[model samples]
Target: MSARAGSFSFDRKDLSRFLFDLYDYEPKLLRKLISARPYVCPFEDIERHIPEDAKVLDVGCGNGALLAILLASGRVKVAVGCDVHEGALASARMAAERTGNAGHVSFLKIRGFEELPADSFDVVTMVDVLHHVPEGDRVKAVEEAIKRVAAGGIFLFKDMVEAPFWRRLAHNVDDLIFSGEWVRQVKTAKVEAQVKAAGFELFESLEIPRIFYGNTLRVFRRL
Candidate 1:
C-alpha cells in the first residue's frame, strides 16, 4: 500500500527500507532499537486508524518513530511529539530535517504539562507510555493526553499487555532496559474503563500478542 500528500509519500513495502535509511547515522544501539521496533510494535495497526490530513500530537513520543510514520503514510498535515528525553528529541529533529519534514513536524521537550500547547489536535496518541509513567501519575497523564483530543477527535492508546505471568515478566525486563525502572502495569479492562469514564467512547479494542512482547490497543472517540 502507498499514500502521498504534499511532499510525503510512503509505501508499505518500503517501511523497513525507509527506517533503515532514516536512522543509518545513529549509534549501533539506537539503530538496533529502531530496526527492531517495527517487528515488535504494532505500528501498522495503529497507522490505519489515524485520519488523513490530520493534525497530530503524540505524548511520550520516544524517538518520534510513530509521528514520522504518520507524517509519511497518513498524510498528516502537522505532527508534534513530546517527550522528556533530549537525546531522542535530537534524533527526531534530525529525522524530520532529513526527510524534509522540518516544516511540518516538531518535537517538544515536555518537563511539565504546562509546556504543551493549549490547542487541541485532530489526533492524539500515547503509545507504550502509560506503563512507564509512575503509578501515581498515570491517571493525570492520561487525562492530560485526552484533553488534547479535539471534540470528535480520536485518542489512540497503546501499551504493553499486563497479563500471563510469564509474559509480564518478560515485559518487565524489556521495560527495565528501555525505561530503566520497574513500572507498574494496569489491567486492560481497568484502562478501558478509565477512559470510558473520562467522556470517551471506545470505538475499537485490540489485543496483540507476541512471543516476547504483547500490546493492548484502545481507540477512543471523544464524546
Candidate 2:
C-alpha cells in the first residue's frame, strides 16, 4: 500500500510504533492492513454464497473490516467476530459501533482456536490474520474455524502469499524496507492443504495485487 499521508510505511519499527502509540490498537493494525490491500476480491464471488441472515463468523476478525462490509450489505443478519487479542476485540467492537453495525456484530475475546465452539456458525472467515498465528497452531486454527461453520456455508480467506521468486523477494524487501514487518510467515500452499484437510473444499483461487503487497484470495466451502 502507498504510504498514507502522515502514516509511515508499516515495517517492524512502524509496527512497534503503532503497537505503542495505539497499544489498544490491535484492531486498528488489522484495519490498516486490510485498508492497504485492494478492495475485498473475495467478496465478489462469495457474496452470492452467503444466505440471508446467515450466522456468519469472522474468525481472526481483527477490527471488523469484513464484518462491517458484510453487515452493511444487508446480507448477514447475524455476525460474530472473534480474536485472540483482547485489545483487538475491543477495537473491533468500537468499529462496529462507529459503523452503525453494533446491533449486528458481536466481538469476542478468545484465547485460542479452542475457545470457539465447533460447528457453531453458518460461515467462518479468516482474513489477514492467519500468517500472524504461530506456525504450529495454524492448522488447528483452520480446523477450528471450519468446525465453526455450518455445512454448505463458506470459509473465506484473502491474504498475503508466497508468490513467484521475484514477487516474493519484493514482498520481503517491502516488508523490510517500508514496514520492517516480516509478515511473520507466509503459508499459501500450507493453508490450501489445511483448509482441505479440515473438511472444506477450495473453490476459488485468485491473484490480487494491492498497495504495499499482493495477496491470494482463497474461498472454500464446507462439505
Candidate 3:
C-alpha cells in the first residue's frame, strides 16, 4: 500500500524517513523501535484500508505513529488519537508537530472509552488493544468503540490470537516479563459476537502474518 502526499506516493522508505524525521531519533534506536514488540504490523497493511478524505479515530494510539502516517498521506481530513498514557500522548503530540500535520490531527489524554463521542468518526481503529483490556470489560469496551463509528463507517480491530503451544508459551512469557500483565488470548469467535451484539455486521476478516505474533484483522461495518 502506498500513501499519497499531494502528488508524491509514499513507499516503505518514505514511511521510515518520515518516522525518523518526526521522532528525530538515532538510526539504530529508530530501527529497534520499529522492529521491536508491540509495533510489528507493517504500515502498508494498515494504509491499504484507509480511504481518501477519511476522518479517523485511533483508540489506544501509542505515540500516534499511525495517525501521523495517515495525516502525512494527505488522504485523511482529520486524525484523532487517544491514549491513557501521558508519555505516549506527549510523544504523539511531538510527532504530529514535527510531521507538520498538527493542524490535521489531535491527540487527547483519555481515562477510558466513555470520554469519546458517538458517531464521530468514519474509521475507528483498535490495534493490539483489545487483548490488553480486562476480559470481563472487553465487550463493553468494544461496544463503546463501535459507538464512535458513524453510520456505515468501519471499525478496524487488530490483535493477537491464540498460537500453537510453544509460540503461546513464549508469548505469555514475554508479556509477563515486559508488560507485567498476563496476556489473555481472546478467541476470535467471542470478539465477533461482541461486534455483532453492538449492531455491526462483519465486513471482512483476515490473518495478518507476523513473526512472533499471530494477529487477526477484522473489519466491521456499523449498520
Candidate 4:
C-alpha cells in the first residue's frame, strides 16, 4: 500500500489496517466491519483488472473505500468517485486528503448520470450500485456508465447475485439494515445483453461467493 510504481498488489491485512486507522467513525463497530470488508469481498480480484496508470471513474462510490484502495495500489493515475450522498462524499474527500492523494483523487455529487462531465475514462466501474438504483432507472444508469468508458477501455460491474433463497435473503437483509431500502436484483443475462447492445463485448464473468454473499462481476470492453 506504499503507492510504489508498478506495485498494484497489496496484502489484505495491510489494507484492512490502513483503512481501519484511516477514519474515526461513530459507532466503533462500523469502522471495524468496514475495514474488514475487503477480507470477504473481492477487492483484490477487482484491482487485478485495472490497468496501470489508468484514469478511473467509480459510480455510487459509497464511503469511497474502493477508490481509496485503488489510489493506494499505485495502479491508478487519477480517480473520480461520484455519488448522490453528501455524507459519503465528505468521507471520501477525507480519505483522499488524509492519504495525501488529494490531487489525484476527486469526488463529485451527482443525483443523476446527466450531471457527470462529458469525459471518458480508461476504466469505469459500478460496484454494488445498479442494484441500489430504482428498478426503472437501472438500465439507464448502466447505459450512462458505459457511455463514459473510453473506446477499448474496461467497464467493471459488480453486484449481488440473485440465487439460492438464502443468499438473496441475506443480501436483502444487509441492504435493508445499511441502505434502508430493498435492492432490486437484475438478471445477469439481461445485463450482458444490455452491455452488448451498447457496443461493448463481454470479456469475462466472475462469480464471487462469500459467506452469505453471492456476487458476480462482469468485465466488459467497449468496442
For candidate 3, the per-residue lDDT at 128 reads: 78
Compare the candidates by TM-score and give the number of the best one: 4
What TM-score against the true fold does each predicted structure earn? 0.90, 0.73, 0.86, 0.93
Tens digit of per-residue lDDT, candidate 2, span 124-219: 777767766767888888777777777777888866657655556667676566446665555778888977887888988887664445677788
Cα deviation in Å at residue 55, candidate 2?
1.4
Best by lDDT: 4
C-alpha lDDT of residue 125 in model 2 = 77
Candidate 1: clashing pairs of residues: none
The global Cα lDDT (0 to 1) of model 4 is 0.83
Taking the tens digit of each residue's C-alpha lDDT, what string does model 1 give over 11-66?
Answer: 43366566667777898777867867776778778887888788999888877777
lDDT of each: 0.78, 0.66, 0.75, 0.83
Which stretches of candidate 4 lie above 4 Å from their native place?
1-9, 25-27
Q: Write the per-residue lDDT of candidate 4 for residues 90-188, one digit (tens) a residue.
A: 988887776666678889999897776568999999998888888888888988898899999999999888887788888899889977988778787
Put the candidates in TM-score order, highest first.
4, 1, 3, 2
Query: How do all the candidates rank in terms of lDDT, highest first?
Result: 4, 1, 3, 2
What are the clashing pairs of model 4? none
lDDT of 1 at 28: 79
- Local accuracy of candidate 3 as per-residue lDDT tens digits, 74-191: 7688888989898878888877776566888888888888886554898999987877888888887888888898888889988776766665666677678757988888777888
Q: What range of 10 consecutive residues in model 1 has the weakest lDDT sum?
A: 1-10
What TM-score quantifies how close candidate 4 is to the native fold? Answer: 0.93
What TM value does model 2 have? 0.73
Alpha-carbon deviation at 110 in model 4, angstroms: 0.6
